[model samples]
Target: MVIKAQALAYFVVKCTFSGPQDLTLDEQLIRTPGIWKLFVDGSVAGKKCGAGLILSSPEGFEICQAIIFDFPLTNNETEYEVLLAGMKLARSLEAKHLRAFSNSMLVVKHFSGEYEQMDPQTTAYATKIKDASLSFGTFELSQIGRENNGWADALSRLASAKTQSLTGSIYLTEAKTPSIEKKECLEIRQGADWMTPLRNYLEKDILPPNRREELKIKYRASRSIIINGRMYHRSFSQPLLRCLNTEEQYQALEAVHEGICGEHLAGWSLAFKILRQGFFWPTLKVDASEYAKKCVQCQLFATVPRQPPEEMTSVLSPIQFAMWAVDIVGVLPTSTKQARYCIIAIDYMTKWVEARPLSAITEEAAKKFFIEQIILRFGIPKICISNNGTQFNGNKFRKFLHHFGFK
Candidate 1:
């Protein structure tokens, strides 16, 4: 067998302060008549500080040296992540017929079929360890009491000492701490300039001369420039401005402007130039109506229905959380005692009803009720059903749901 197994052997999983030299003498004993299992351990002490590990066979064949780092302000959860990272490295080395040992009862127990309440980070690490074990083909992990784990403890202390040495400079300097916000601010500013070249390209004459003149006329008329057969106007003003030299840019601008002769040219072209450079057309969510609306000929010829068809009316689904029915029952009489109206939310599943009384049947009052009363009580339903009531149709309510995590 490529891997020899001894019937009886001493397997010591130890945490120690003794360096690799301590294992040199024990090398052959580990490979002697019987087999030996060895585990070494250590822990980190400070910021960027970490523990270390040196695993050798019982007879002292070198296995691995691993480092475990810690952040001063971190919790057990973050420490667990560092531990898992260590295990993942070991697994990648393809250790087989192996045993794992740790001073961390939480880590050892959770890994060895012990069910203890673990934070999400630990839980995630445990899952990964199990997955790693399976990928390694065969392995066993066991926990040993500290008394039986002396060598590993010493090694953990050594690792802490090493970490202290490495991070010693950090202790002396106030500027050693990295700035997280500085990188973000740099990225934002750099991103703005990154688009500058693109803006110049657009302003420099990307548009055909004919299109530019058409756009100029549209600017004068305060209208959109729609080319020969397209629904959306291809903006030419900003494209024209990006091509301008510094003198042209300095003479005038609000994105676009009216000439002395009242002829329109690119004014706020500078802003438009930037915009054109950084332009990213959002992916439009298309409904059948939107496509039809965009068709100029169809839009002009299509007749509006006298009233919306009953079938076209949105109906709340039968599933409770699947959809919600909302409507403002209004035209309430103005009275101090009686509320002017109410916004009602009906659950499609439970058929439960929630109502918010409104003073003036105003959109604001209806919205406040929907948020404070309906959403707060029942949670945000996947879909909301509301009639063509002014309150429901207002832009505010749509923006509210969008701002929240809902979708």
Candidate 2:
């Protein structure tokens, strides 16, 4: 009976009803080979902030790391920092499949795309996390209860603690700056150009092998001198002007044309200003002209030309009263009959003028004045021109024009 029970227990242990599809996500992941689990937690005590991370491999081996922040950061930022640290550690280990857990709901939600990140700092952190996630074949982040994340929570609190009384082995790290802040390094390369030959010839007495080029450099070097390691061109009537390279030419033009105390002068004026400031380039005038033209502010606020582009021609009426210009001049001081507006008509060729006063400038008043003062008195005009006022452009005025056969 004892041997039968042992065989039955062995058979039960070997048999499984649940297939891979029926297994929970965590169970499936646990059974997968080469998968890694990450748990991260962040803590803030008083003014200090810190984070803790725990990474476990499929074989059940674990690595723990603690981060002490030297800079001030909020709890949410700390959570993101710890997560990012975990991701870096996994990537360094070449872990292909990663599953991360965080006790902070905000961090998880932001990473999972369930919540919008409104804070600029956190948004930057999220973008960095997303970019880093692409390094792994499979990456998952889920929210867990703080109680369930006890080991990471304890490690985080330990990081914030002043004294560590109990510890075996943990990688303690210090973060001097926020991860989201980027440090930019700019490399300036001064390549060979027109100034390079002159500089080489002047500084080291180096000259080209060609006889013609050698003679040209020798002749040009006569007027150019080196002062404090800088080449300068000798001016007959002015101080020595510093010769500039391609980059320096651009800088000089920008400073003179649009820098602080810049007057936004024209192209030629800009080149002269730079020359007055003791700088010279071969294409200074041309470059200055192009740069000034390209300036958005200069183009936008440029003065408009007052004169017409083409030759001026006078418009002549073939006969008197054939062409008339009608206009309204208004809002004057009250005069007799409480008239505060005046409607006037003029003959284009004869310079004849007729005027009428109006209490209100309206379509009806304009029609009556035009009919009695100009049309009936002088006959219907072949052409009439007026400012685009409602009284002139209204439907009633248009119908009156159509009825009179006026263009």
Candidate 3:
């Protein structure tokens, strides 16, 4: 067994010290024919930021590019920026199979899906890279040590430093903005709206030529003011209320009536909440009501009214202090006195109320309250009504009431 172990150890050492003929599977695959290699690096020096890319063709032809960024970017963002630039260059060259190398472990892992891109900017860059990767037949990204990525790192530093002198073989370029910035053309057509007349009357003193329309615009614009180019309504209740367009009105209603802090309130309450939030539209109340009526969740789980279909008969007392209604009002939040229960008595005729707080509700406590608050202060009542609770209907309370000639 000793000889066998020693033989195995010697064989492993021999393979470990083997020549280039015994290259690992990864090394052999990386050197495969028709595979283009891309080395990317990014650098940020104080306020300046830049990236560098070195693309090597299978035929050993190299393309080195240095990009200086006009916008400020973080270290990881620069890494992704350079990587995306390199991929675009490779795609233009018609590279079918590409293997990218970066000294940034975060960039490599994010591209390979080992690390999640939590930052919004980096995530956008990662998404763009993945979409661009479809242009190539095969794509692979690997992380290398900073020392191994010397040439790309040097070019990135040079670009970041904005060195005036550089080798003629290195292609230089300037990026005015980030590669991920959206540049789609948007067409904005102006149409006549309510705010347009008011804004015009307030800002440019422009109004309709007709006498009636001109008078109307002048009257409306008198109640409106322009601050920082935005029209606001001069409100009576509030200092100023921001006016909303048709689109903004809908957004505000939806957000206030059903957004995260929304309670699915009634239309009137919803409109009031929006007003309190400093947003104003001409039809805010109507729009809020309509929005609430259309809410599926509100309708599905709405509370049904418990009112009688016919009519509710009224209860009457002959004279003041002749009859009293008694009830307990708590298990409320404990007060500083450690009292959590309250007993209340109300006269049916005059509607006089008497209340006392208690730490606990017991028969003795109920009886004591009845004598002190009811009989002592307002005289004895002819009839005493309760909810038939344990504290009010207990044997001791009944006996105490019986002793007092209460029927």
Candidate 4:
């Protein structure tokens, strides 16, 4: 039984996660590793249910470990059974170890031996998975929230669409508010001279047609190119050709293209242009200063915007009695004649914070307040901290602390 269509529609909206700030600890641990993290997610496509598995790591990312295979038409149980097909495929990676985190508690628990299978169909899947895991390296299964499993879930739907050869489409719309003056961007000015070197390299050398067309499509074909008879577009050929010319220049260009260009360019058009001639000779090699200046885009866009220095925060770890961070939050609208200030104290180690509403922020008021409200409570916190302000630097405050046997 397949729940593919219904599952896909529900999965599209259901699997979206808010962001990293919202992910739980279990989800975080699964994603944080630099190595491979295999994600398996399921969706409903009409009566047929589909599952997707994606492998991601420092090596790069790939989709299509497995997708929807026609199952006996029924419910989510068959959907889940079919989903394990991806896990069986995962065994081919021969990963040193595996960490399987899923939003489906039923699947997670059954695999972890926390839940027993009540359904016979699921029982078979459970048994097969046990054998599959043993066939691979060591493995651990953990339960994660559906919200945290979004990326995998998305991949699953994509895989299913591909597997079934279904015409699935995704569209993005951007509405620009009319500007009084349109923003002008600096573009690479390519002349006839730019094509001369590339032509010489491609025609003179025994260049692969795929390679030649790749570079030509990338660097050349967009605006206008005159051929023998007809006019045609060579988009992919030019940019890819530029990449093949010099290995070092290609790498540097690829870095800028993937990093800076990829971020700013939205739909089809590119925001930044990398001219073949602009890439200098010494820029390709590792020289101290010239390499640095070669990235004009970085010079323009990559510099961190200057910020007013923040209130210096102490990195001193919280210790039992060593360092402290203290601050005051006040100007209370609730304050009356009885209380005009609030004294706050925090322990550097324990994260213990103390606060008191004061009648005044005077030297005597500060001393008397700390002695009664704080010093007596936690003994002496060794190091007291406050912003460089008049309330703490006053003479009576110094004398009051001295009289109390504190530095």
lDDT per residue, candidate 3, 311-363, as tens digits?
Answer: 88887998899788899998999997899999998999999999999998999
**Residue-wise lDDT of candidate 4 within 90-154, one digit each (tens)?**
55444556666567778888887888788876776677678667755567766667777665565
Residue 88 local lDDT, model 3 = 81
Report how far residue 155 has shifted in candidate 2, in Å: 0.7
Report the lDDT tens digits of candidate 2 across residue range 1-407: 11111110111111121211232246665557888988889988877776777787777667766566777889999999989989988886778899898989998889889998899989999998998898898998988777767767765775455554333432223477777763221113345567777888888889999999999988888889875345789977889898987778888888788888999997788888888899887788898889988999998998979999999998789899999998999799999999999999999989999999999999999889879988889999999898879999999988988899886
Q: Estimate each model's TM-score.
A: 0.29, 0.39, 0.39, 0.32
- TM-score of structure candidate 3: 0.39
TM-score: which candidate is best?
A: 2
RMSD of 4: 28.2
lDDT of 4 at 203: 44
- TM-score attained by model 1: 0.29
Lowest lDDT 10-mer window, candidate 2?
4-13
Give candidate 1 regions above 4 Å deviation: 1-48, 57-59, 64-86, 158-407
TM-score winner between candidates 2 and 3: 2
Question: lDDT per prediction?
Answer: 0.46, 0.78, 0.76, 0.51
Shift of residue 207 alpha carbon in model 2, Å: 30
Model 3: residues >4 Å from true position, as ranges? 1-27, 160-166, 170-172, 182-407
- The alpha-carbon lDDT assigned to residue 62 of candidate 4 equals 46
